[model samples]
Target: MSDLRTRPTTKRPPTGDLAAEGRRRRASIAAFYTVLIVVAIIYIYPFVIQAGTSFKTDGDSTYNPLNPFPSLFTLDAYATLADVDFPLWFRNSVIVTAFVTVGRVLLCSAAGYALSRLHFVGRKFLLAAILAVMAVPGVVLLIPKFLILNQLGMYNTFSAMIIPLLWDATGIFIMKQYFDTIPPAVEEAARIDGAGVVRRFWSIMLPMAGPALVTLTVFAFQGSWNEFTHFIVARSSAETNTLTTGVAALTTGQFGSGNRYPLKLAAALIMTIPVALVYFVFQRKLVRGQGGGAVKG
Candidate 1:
């Protein structure tokens, strides 16, 4: 007869120096967190100051420039913003950003899919040209964009501001890289079932590109929202003024005079809200999106 239960084995005590190892590991962890906290403070301090300054009086902001607290807490800055054409500038910015984001996403995705799947003449050359455009400095295009906008009668118009930004080389590059990672057989199966190129792309391929699309959407939104350089050259009318251009004018005393730190900071603070919300919402997906184009094989 066999014993039903096995004998319990004696557990050995841990060998020497484990306590020392544990203390060292704890110390290392402490040091790592200490550095992280310091860096976070460094990055976050300015934003805190920005928010605080928005509530400050101009005199407080200037005399105690580094002070984050208001000498006299007030809503005058925000009140001033409310009285002015700030809402108009905000609306114009929203309009341009909406158009640019949606247009860039659709156009860039289509261009990327075509470059990835369709075998057409000059495709490689076109991709190379896009790369070359990316290589070209943005400052170099300012004058040309202005001139072309003027010639095309799109100057001082929303079309001028958004059309130029709707399809950038970066978006195309991102989409193409992501699409390259997708297996060809997926599209081929769609084709075998009587799906056409447009149908397959719109129905299957575009939807499969969720990560890239999210990345593109966020990028487009932020870029268009924060765009200053192009807006400067694209339009001169106050009616077409976006937040970036409008804020610049406000800073230069076009709207108001004298330091106006609180007012300026208030505008900046408001401008930051939309981009921050978008980034926070899609941040996790933004991280995952980077992996779409990172295929090893």
Candidate 2:
């Protein structure tokens, strides 16, 4: 009885089932990476071809559309595009994107904060209206937006491009959801210190909302920078053309003197640079925002 505490039992050997389970898990992981690698190659190969083709001659592009290496690399396409409206198009895109991104971020955040935190008479109804607007298809609004812009006499102007898109329903929704997730205790502390609504939002809330704000900035910048349809309906003059419209014109035999594939590809590659940069820079935030917002929704 005294030595019973020191007694030991026989240990069991490893089971076949455990070994089988480990093998199955390893196989599943290997299959997942195999599929992932294939998918990544499929998505990335087109860009590789386009980038390579941009450096090739027109004859080389036609002959070797699938080739990622050119028989003879030429800078003529880029050199030629540099001599045309590329600079103007780039400038216009920068101006429009800057204005629209700034406007959308500020306006959407303001609207969202008010909608989420403020207690107004029609807050519920207004929130519902914003949700409804978000559901409306953007492509269907092409004509209506054009008519309203035309009637307001904003057509063919920068105002035409910027005004209608100054605020978006979807952006407002994202901001509202993010704001709602913020802990009320922090806000309460601010209010207890006798800070007003504006001060609380500016000094307390916004600073704490760095992640959401960065996410919104990325979306606004990308959306406005790549905007195509709104520009088409809002302005018609070459002087007002954005990169999207100008490059589109290039593709449809509207400029460049011939079916200039290399020139157009070069232009596309250039236009893609900003978006690619933004995507890579904020990819982590983008994934986080997506997951957080999905949870809230």
Candidate 3:
């Protein structure tokens, strides 16, 4: 009885089979990692080459198109950028991105809360309209946007550049989705305590949306910072040029052309830094927001 109790109820898999299965699992994992590494390299190689080319001389970059390591490193490109209005462009981008981000976060959160919680006539219709707007191609609206800005007499001003982007369909959609996931019980308790609608949203609910807020902020900053086409249509002066337009002008030989690859690459590299930093800092929060729980118990 004791021996039977100590023994296996059924025969276990043979040692050879277990070994073979283990080997197969290891091989599968190895293959997965190999593919992942290859894909990462493919995605990252362009940025690596861009950084390398920025440090190379113009002749070196033109000659060594495939090589990431500079044959003759130089800082002439950076110096050239300094002589231009690069600092001014950087300042303009910073100012525009900051204001746009703040406005989008505040306005989108308010709109999202109203759409998700408040009952009003045409609420569903308004959401449907927002969805429809999201589906429309942004390029199709460029002419209309330009016309509106011109009619408003906001053309060639920072207002034209920043105001149109202050509230976006995507931000509202994201916030609404997040708000919907919040349990109604929490808001009900706040209401029972005599909290007003705005008080409940601001002091109770918005505080719980930290991850979603961070995600929205990241997207807003990136979009506004990289905005080029709208800026082009909105403003026509060199003073209003952001990094995107300024760098583009450098690439197109506004200064002078003969393959000034280094200058262009340097400008591109500088412009990418802020977005990259923001992404890295809030990447974990963004992931949490996507997983649908900003306020985890």
- Minimum summed lDDT over a 10-residue window in model 3 is located at 288-297
Please provide TM-scores, in order, for all candidate models, with all chains considered together.
0.91, 0.88, 0.92
Segments of candidate 3 deviating more than 4 angstroms: 1-8, 290-297
lDDT for each residue of candidate 2 in 1-297, tens digit (9 for 90 to 100): 365566688976579878998899999999999999999999999999889989999898888889989899899989978877889999999999999999998899889899989998999999999999888889999999999999999999999998888899988998899889888888888788788888877777676666778888888999999999999999999999999998888777556565577888899899999989988988987677533221110
Better of 1 and 3 by TM-score: 3
Worst 10 residues of 1 by lDDT: 288-297
Off by over 4 Å in 2: 1-26, 254-259, 288-297
Pairs of residues clashing in candidate 1: none
| Comparison by TM-score, 1 against 2, better one | 1
- State the TM-score for model 3: 0.92
lDDT (C-alpha, whole model) for all candidates: 0.89, 0.86, 0.89
Give one digit per residue, the lDDT tens place, for model 3 in 178-220.
8998899998888887889988888777877777788889999
